[model samples]
Target chain A: MSAELRRLLAEVAERESERFARTHPDDDVLLYERAVAPRRALRRTAQASGVAAVAASVALGFVAADAVVTDRRDATPAASPSGTSLTPTGTGWTELPEDSAADAWRVSGRPLDAFFVPEGPDEAVLVGADVTGDALTTCQVLDAFARFQMLADAAEAPLPEAPLSSQRLGGFHGLGDVGVYEAEFTRRAGAAAYLALMVEAAQMCRQAVGGAAVVNVEEDVAFSAVAGGGMRVDISRDGTDPWRLWVHVQQGRMLTVIAEPGGADEVAPVITSYFTAWDR
Target chain B: MSAWHGVLEELIRQRRSALVGYAYLLAGDRPLAEDLVHDAIIRTFSRARRLENVGAAEGYVRRAILTLFLNNRRSRSRALAKQHLLVVPDVAPPDDAAGDHDVVVCALNGLAPRQRACVVLRYFEDLSTAETAERLGLSEGSVKRYVHDAMVHMRGELGDIDPGPEPTPQSVVLVKGGAR
Candidate 1:
C-alpha cells in the first residue's frame, strides 16, 4: 500500500472509529446483538413473557424457559458446558474444550448431528451445551418445540404420521435423504397447538393491526435426514413484514427461533444465541 | 483484579471504538454494533487472562468482534439490510451535515456487505496487512489482496483511479449514524 493510500485508510478508519455509533441507528443494536448472541450462544435465562409462558405450558408441549440475559455475557465458569473451560482472553470470553467435564450431565463437542426424542423431555436435557451448559437441554429443547409448533401452524398441517429414526447424514449421525420429510415434520411437531395458532395467525394475517405476526430465523440445514450438508434453508423475516417466514435447508445444524410481532426483535438475539451457543 | 474484571477493564480501555466500529460495519447498522461489541468484550474478558501471546487486548478483541460480525448473517442480516435500505430514504437523513469522509462512507454503503466490510476495514480501519489478517482470521496475503481489490473498486466512486468491470455506480451512501 502506498503511503498516501495507507494514510487515507488510516484517516478513514479513524473517522469511522469516531463515527461508528452515528452511521447506524439504535434499533440495529438489537439486530447486531441478536446476531452476536448466536455466535457466542452464551447461556441465558429470561422470564417467559405473557402468552409465551402460557402457550408454552399448553398443547405446544414447550416450556417457556425464556431468559432475559439483558447483559450480553459469557456463561460463568461454573455454568460453562461440560468439557468446556473459560480462558480470559481480551475483554469478554472464550471457551476452550476440555478433555472432558462431568459426564453425568454432559454436552458433546461433537456437533449435535442427530436428535431422537424417544419419549421426549425426560428429566435429561437434550441440547444442554447450547443453552445452560450440561444443565437441562430443557430450555433449548422447549424453545425448539415452540418454534416447530409455529412452523406446523403455518403449513396448516400436523406432525409426522410415522415414527422416525436410524437416519444419517454423509454416513454421520444426521438427517439423510428422508430429511425433507423430517424437516417438515419437525417444523410442525405440535399439530394441535399449531392448528389452533393457525386460526389466530390467519385472523391476524388479515386484520387491520395484522392482529399479530409469527416470525422465525432459519440457517443452512439439511431438511433431509439422509443428507448431511448440501443445500441451505435461510429464512429471515420480522416485523417490517406483516408476515415473514424463513426456511433453512443447508448442510449444518438447524437453529430456528420464533417470536410474535412485538416480541420479534427481543426474541431474535435469543434465537441467534442458540446458534452462537452451538458454534462456540 | 479477578481475571474477568482485569480483562474487561483493559479491553474497554483498548478497543472501545475499533472493536465497536468493526462490529457496526459487520452488522451494517449502529445499535447492533454496540451490542455486538459489548457482548464480544464480555466474551473476550472471560478468555482475557488466557490470551497469552497477543500484545494489546485490542488484537484479541478485534478478532473476536470480527468473527462474531461475520458469523451473524448466515441469511437473515442481509434481508434486514435490504429492508432498512429501502426505507431509509423515506425516513429523512438523520443528519444534514456530510463531511468529506462521510462522502466516502456514503459511497461505501452502496457496495455489498463483504465488499463494504473489506473497504471499511482496509481504508477506514487502516489495519495493517498482518493486523487485518488477525482481525478477519484471514491470511496477510489475502488481506493485502482484498485491500487492493476493494480500493480499485472504490477509486471509481471515490474519485477515479481505475475503472474496472464493476460499473461506476451513480450513488454510494455510506451509513453515517452513530451515538455521537
Candidate 2:
C-alpha cells in the first residue's frame, strides 16, 4: 500500500512540476542581481579598506563624564560638506561629522549636551536634557537597563555565555526620542550568538515600546551578516514615521542604535563611522 | 566572471525551472516557490563554500531551499503577529482547480507544513525515512509518524486512485564541504 501510495504521489508531483515549469518559464535575472548586490558591495568595501582579515582591538578611552557635559554647551549646528548634501531631506539627522554624538542626538530633537556618570570601568550612564533643561535622572537610566535585563531573562532560551562588559547607556531623550546603548563582550561572542541576541532584543524592544512600533523581520531588512566579520540586524518599526533599532556587532563590540522616526540610511553611516573609529 | 558566479549563472539557466517546481511542490504557491528558490540561491552563493561544479551548487541550493522553507514555516506565527506593519500583504497564489493534480495538491496542502515536507521528501524526492529525518533534523520515529499521518489524510482525499508500480528512485547527490 505504501509503495502504491508513493507511486501515486510521484505521478502527481511530476504533472504539477511540469505545469509550473510551463507557466513560469522565464528566469528572474533581476531578482538574482538584487540578491547578490549586497555581497558585491561588501566585497568592495573590504578590499578598499585594506583591512581584510585584520582584527585589531583598540581600547577607546571611557568618555569623561565632564566631557559629555562640556560638549553639550559647545554644540554647534551640523555643517554639510562642500559639493555634497550631508543631511537627508526632512530628517533632523545630518550626514556630516559622522561620528559626532551631538549630531546623533539631533535625530531625536535634542542637543548633544548630556551628563555622563561613570558606573564602572566598562559602564556609564548618560542623562540628556530636553529644550526645557529637564534631564533624566540616574534612576531612570537604571530603570531602562533593568527593563532590558528583565526582557532578556524572560526570553525562551538563555543568551550566549559570553559575558558582556564595557556597557554604556546613551542619553535618554524621553519616550518620543531615539535612545542608544552599547556594550562589548569580554571575549569574542560568535556572530551567530550575536544575531540571536539581536532578534531577542528587537522583539523585547518592540513590546516595550507600545503603539504602532511593530518589528519588521523581512530578509533584506531584518538581518544581514557581512562576509568578513560583521553582523547587522535592523528591526524597523512601522513605515514613514518609522522607528529603527539597529544592532551591529564587529570584533567583540556590540552597538545598539535606536532611532525613533529614522531610516536605515540615516543611522547606517553613523554606525560605520563608530566602527571605523574603533578599528583605528 | 568568478567560478562561483559562473556556476550560479549556469545553474539558473539550466536548473532554475526544476528548482522552482520542487519548491512549488513543497510550498503549494507559485510566487512563494519562486522566492524560496531565489533566496536559496543567494544563501548558497553568499557564503564562501567550495562548490566544485554546477551539480554541487545545485545540491547546495536544494538543501538551502528545504532549510529556508522549514525555517519560514517555523517563523510564520512571528511574522503574522506583525502582519499589519507590512506594506503589502503576502497573499498566497490563487489555487487553480483546473489542473489534473489539484486533488493531490489540495490534499498535500491539507497536511501540516512539516508533514507535507516529510511526504514530499519521502515520496516525491524519494528519500528514505532516515534520510528525510536527517534532512529535517527530526528523529526517525517522528518522520515515520508524520509520513504515516500525511498518507492517511492524503488517501482519504484521493480515494480509489490507481496505485501503479513504484518507479525507480532517483539518486540525489548532496556535496559536503566546510565554509572557507
Candidate 3:
C-alpha cells in the first residue's frame, strides 16, 4: 500500500480509538441516573447481578470506636489517627522513569474513583469534583499527561532522609485555587518501611481556601476501612499511624481504587502504586 | 440512561458492523465491546429525553463510548484489562494500517495526555483547532502548539513528513532561546 494510504489508515484507527474512548456517555448517563436515584438504579443494577446496590458500607469487626455507615449519598469523616504530627515530603520515593509504562505502579482492582494529578503546567487540572473533607484535604486530579511530567520531576533521588520521617510542610497547587496543606508520615512493615500522609494546607488546596470559599456539597468525605479478606489490619488510630485507603476520581466518577501497604505487606509500594495510577 | 439505545437499534439495523467495529476499537475486547454497546443501549433508553437531535445522537453515543473507555481505564487496570480480551476478527485491531499507525500511536504516547487529546481532536475528528480548544476547554494557542508539536513528532516517528522542530528528549528541560 502507498505511504499515503497507510497514513490515512493510521489516522482512521487513531480517530476510531479516540472516538471509542470518548463514547462512554451511555455508562456516564447510567451512572448519572444511578447517582441521582440510587434505589431505582440499584434495583435495576442489582437485579441484573442478583445482588443489592451499594447503599452503604457495613461496619466490620473494628470495635475501638463508632464506625459511621457511609452510603453513596455522603462521605464519612476520615477517622485519622491524631496527636503525632504529619510532615509532608516528596522525598525517599524513587519516581518512575519517564515514558516507561507505569506497569509497576498499576492499580490492582476496581476503585470508587481514580485520580490523575498534574505533574506540570502543561495540562492544567481541568476538572475538580470531590467537594468533601476540609476543602483543605481534597486530592487533586490533572490530565494524566501533565502528571507524567510532574512525576518525572518528583522522580529525583531521595532526600538523604531514607524514610521521610520528618519534614517541614508547605503548600502545593493542583486545580486552580485549591491549596494543599501537605504532611507526610513514616510507616514500618515486616522488613521495609515507607511514608504516608495527612494533608492540611498546601499549594492548590490552600490557595483555593484562601481565594474563595467553595460551595460545599452534601457528600461527606469518607475513609471506609474495608477489610479485603486477606491480611488487612487496622492500625491504632491514635494519630501515631494508621493504614491508608486511596481513591482516584475523574470527571465525577470513581476511577482508581487502591490501598497502601497493599497486599498485607509494603506500604510504600502500595502508596507509589496509588500515586502512579491515581490520575488527578 | 444512555440516549442511544433506540437509535442504536436503528443503527444496528443500518450500521451494526460499524458500531461493533467502534466498540471493538474502544474496548479492545469483543465480548466487552458488545456488553458496552448493550449497556449503552440500555442507558440511552432512559437518556433519550436529554438527547436533542435524533440525527446527531450517534455522535453523542460515540462520545459516551469513548468516555466509558477512559473511565474503565481509570477505574481498574487489571479488571478493565479484561475488556481487551482477544477475539477473532471481523473488526480486529487494525494492525494492517496502510500508514504509520505505529508511529502515530507512539508519537501520541509521547505527548502529555492533553496534547495527544488535542492532536486527536484536531486531525482525527476533523475538528477545527478552535473547536478542539473549546471542547477541551484549552486556549487556542495551547491547542495550536499541541497540534504542531504532535505533528512534528508524528512526522519523525511515523513517516518522513517533517512537520516542525524536533521533539525535546523526555528528560531535557525546555529552554527558551537565551539570546540576551
lDDT of each: 0.35, 0.48, 0.33
Model 2 local distance difference test score: 0.48
Q: Determine which window of 10 residues in candidate 2 chain A has minimal summed lDDT.
A: A127-136
What is the per-residue lDDT of model 3 for residues A88-159, given as tens digits with 9 covering 90 to 100? 223321233322233223222211111222121111211222233223122221111111111211222111
Off by over 4 Å in 1: A1-280, B24-28, B48-55, B73-97, B113-145, B160-180
Query: Which one is best on TM-score?
Result: 2
Which is the winner by DockQ between candidate 2 and candidate 3?
2
Task: Please tell me what DockQ candidate 1 reaches.
Answer: 0.08
Clashes of 3: 80
Residue A145, candidate 2: alpha-carbon lDDT? 33
Show the colliding residue pairs in model 2. Answer: A72-A113
DockQ of the candidate models in sequence: 0.08, 0.16, 0.06
Candidate 1 interface RMSD after superposing interface residues: 8.3
Q: What is the fnat of model 2 with respect to the true interface contacts?
A: 0.24
A1-280 in candidate 1: lDDT tens per residue? 3444445545555555566434443323333332322222111111112233235224332111113111113322123434332223232111222232331112222222122222111111122112222122222223333234222112212222211211211101111111111222232222222222322332222231121222222222222211111111111122242112222211222223232222223222222323234222
- Interface RMSD list for the candidates: 8.3, 9.9, 11.3
Model 3 alpha-carbon drift over 4 Å, by segment: A1-11, A14-280, B1-5, B12-48, B52-54, B66-73, B77-99, B162-180
> Cα deviation in Å at residue A195, candidate 1?
33
